[model samples]
Target: MGRRLIVGTTIDRVDDKSLTENSAAANRTSLWGGRFAGGPSEALARLSVSVQFDWRLAPYDIAGSRAHARVLAGAGLLDPEELGRILAALDDLEAACASGTFRPTVDDEDVHTALERGLLERLGSLGGKLRAGRSRNDQVATDLRLYLRDHARGVAARLVELAEALVEQAGRHVDTAAPGMTHLQHAQPVTFGHWLLAHVQPLLRDLERLRDWDHRTAVSPLGAGALAGSGLPLDPGAVSKELGFRTSFANSMDAVADRDFVAEFLFVTAMIGVHLSRLGEEVVLWTSQEFGWVELDDAFATGSSIMPQKKNADIAELARGKSGRLVGGLVAVLTMLKGLPMTYDRDMQEDKEPAFDAVDTLELLLPALAGMISTMTVRVDRLVAAAPVGFSLATEVADWLVRKGVPFRDAHEITGKLVALCAARDCALDEVSDADLATVSEHLDPSVRDVLSVRSALAARITPGSTGPGPVADQLATAADQLTTWRNWTAESVVPR
Candidate 1:
């Protein structure tokens, strides 16, 4: 029976007889096949195969090969012609990968195995020298770091796009009053822009985590071969420089074993998911008939199959749902690495799928979320109408009393009684008569009516980062500057194609 491999868009079947007949069979079997009498069991092959998902690492693997070939030439392991030939073969492999002409065969267990076969097919015996001082353990670790380092910058850029959308929307609504809530009950009057900027602040922190994570991920692990330092005097630093890494591993064991970088990346991504989910929940609420605070654009929304009037916020709903998958990815990596011993294990192979999943998930999510936010129509009239209801101006009333020389505790009591009176009369605090207010407390002078309006309530919150127009305007400017700085950083740091 033959093993069926999926190479790019084609399926290749390599029989046992063909495996023995082909000179490159050893490349497909195991990089170390001297002791094995036969190929891997069908079950083992099925369990070990990762070329399906890890094929995305092909470019990084090729990049590492090019650098490794140079290091080999420097170490006197390969002649100049051999190094040049190897680099050329790697370049060809990368092109084939890009064109979707090269793919993994079923017998190719992982990307390293698949590429090695491609190299050997291209260079005959000369390609064999490329693996001299490298091991799959080190190769994969280096490739993952390279992959993540590039994608982290991409994620950073996308996050900035999202933040930019928020800031733009906030700028438009700085003067539009909205009801702010605590425990889902109206607690204060705030500008709609303030609420939007709150989401931006957390995204800024997520960007910081990504920048910090990138610093840690920039260390290369190429010279750590199968849990030990390479025996050859090859310069790992040379490979690190070639691959855009800022540094090389200090300890070989730690180099191959450390998946902390992947976990950290996942954690940051999960935190991003959580933050986006919170915003998504708000979007879901705001678009509802009861809230009526915003409406999703037709492009970002979908119609329910059976309902003629249905405009479902499917994008926001998906953003909320996908957050669980992001958290699950982080948890999966942590659990897989928890009991593994020092150095590399087969279990480490499980790391890429979750990490890659988180990346793919966010890559799809962030841009759509940005578009949803950028195009949505904010119902400023509805927000303004709701902002002053539910006794949201109670806090301002208390503050007015405090300004009248009443202690805050007494002021709170007076405001509470006013709120109670309004509730009993089924009226708004502002609708309460001056006589009724004075009966509640002598502090309730005519000046008390000054802060009763929602506009006045928003204006009274003049502290930094408050919901007042001035503070929110300051926040909007700060957000714009911060986003610009991050955008510049992303453009400067992005990995070249």
Candidate 2:
């Protein structure tokens, strides 16, 4: 199937519906309506509904319910027959939900409320037993964790795919020389492979971040019971194990209240965004007329509507632009979390939208970027030709002088002056007359010409992890190994395909 982002949201104009009907199904939205004499006002219903976005959590919620049902069965809240029927009904409802045959109604308040309504319809009064010793507070917390944990696995998978693309490109360009830049000016000669591997380092760290995030996220909040321990003997550990969590939470209030996982997830996603933006910025620059170091594949580039000659790097531009949205998601979740007191609050419902939006952004972006990186043509000739521009070999001159017992400061000054002399004479560094080299500095000799070539400059950077071709080849090997390890982790993370 073609890649797409599927989300449930109320960010746009909402669908208008009448909530005035007094039916029990419509009123089922307000689980707390038991305390009120009358149902909520239509205005409140319209403003308060979260099924619009939270419905995306339905599958996770159902999974939690399945686990919770087993816990309830263990607690003897229901007999064996009731447990079997509820489990069977949950399976049917899950399939219906996944196939889109089942959906949240207009009056369903949130994912928890909507799923409960579905349960009630499926098993009648028997479904109400499953709600024993549980509340939406803990249910939502558990469900969100399940949802993000699963998606994080998928994110890690897609991220590794992007890294693989970079590694493959780096392999192709391992011997291709390019100008490594500082302050937008060529600073040194480097293999394009080395520069590409530099981008992969941060992505490897991102994979580690996701792997670590899973550790903290694996504690289940399912039995927290509306911010207090359940009076019933629910086996939270059993439920946690059944739901694939490493452990059950120790504190009920903290379990429901803690949103550290979400905020951390936002930060992780934002960091990935920032990294991709940097890669995107380079793509934009390299594909431009001024750089001409890269050419986008026809499949990836778009034609400008007004400018017929333009083949725009829209994927790169969007990747760069959407980073702000990812950062904004982090900010949104953090800000919403800042003022909340202990336990779950309505404010936290807003968390899913931002979190979901970022996942949507990355899901669409990573594959497109991977394809772009894999297919786009690297202009090796342009890269090699530009490697020595802007007195790029001046550093080589300074380093050569340093080897000849010249102080680096004095050598720097001599190289600077030589560069100026070349600029004034409108010539290459090697093109300078021997007398000019003699006049510029006594340190300058005919042998300085030996270090002026791009190949020599590339070979001179021999330190570990330097832009030298050997280190770059090693870097690609290291990156490929890291990508392999992460690929194994995602495969075991148990996220549905």
Estimate, for each residue in 1-497, the C-alpha lDDT of model 1 and write its tens digit. 11111123222222223222234554453576688897668798788778777877787788788889899999999988888888888888888877757766767777888788898889998988888898999999998888788777778889999999999999999999999999999999889999999999999999999988888888999999987898899999988877777889999999999999999999999999999999999999999999999989999999977998999888889999999999999999999999999988899988998888888889889999999999999998999999887888899888887887889999899899999999999998778888997899887877777888988888778899899999999999888999989987676542222
* All candidates: TM-score: 0.94, 0.94
- List residue ranges in candidate 2 displaced over 4 A: 1-29, 495-497
Local distance difference test, each candidate: 0.85, 0.86
* Clash list (residue pairs), candidate 1: 5-105, 5-106, 7-103, 8-103
Q: Lowest-scoring 10 consecutive residues by lDDT in candidate 1? A: 1-10
Clashes by residue pair, model 2: none
Q: Which candidate has the highest TM-score of all? A: 2
For residue 192, model 1's alpha carbon misses the true position, in angstroms, by: 0.4
What's each prediction's clash count? Answer: 4, 0
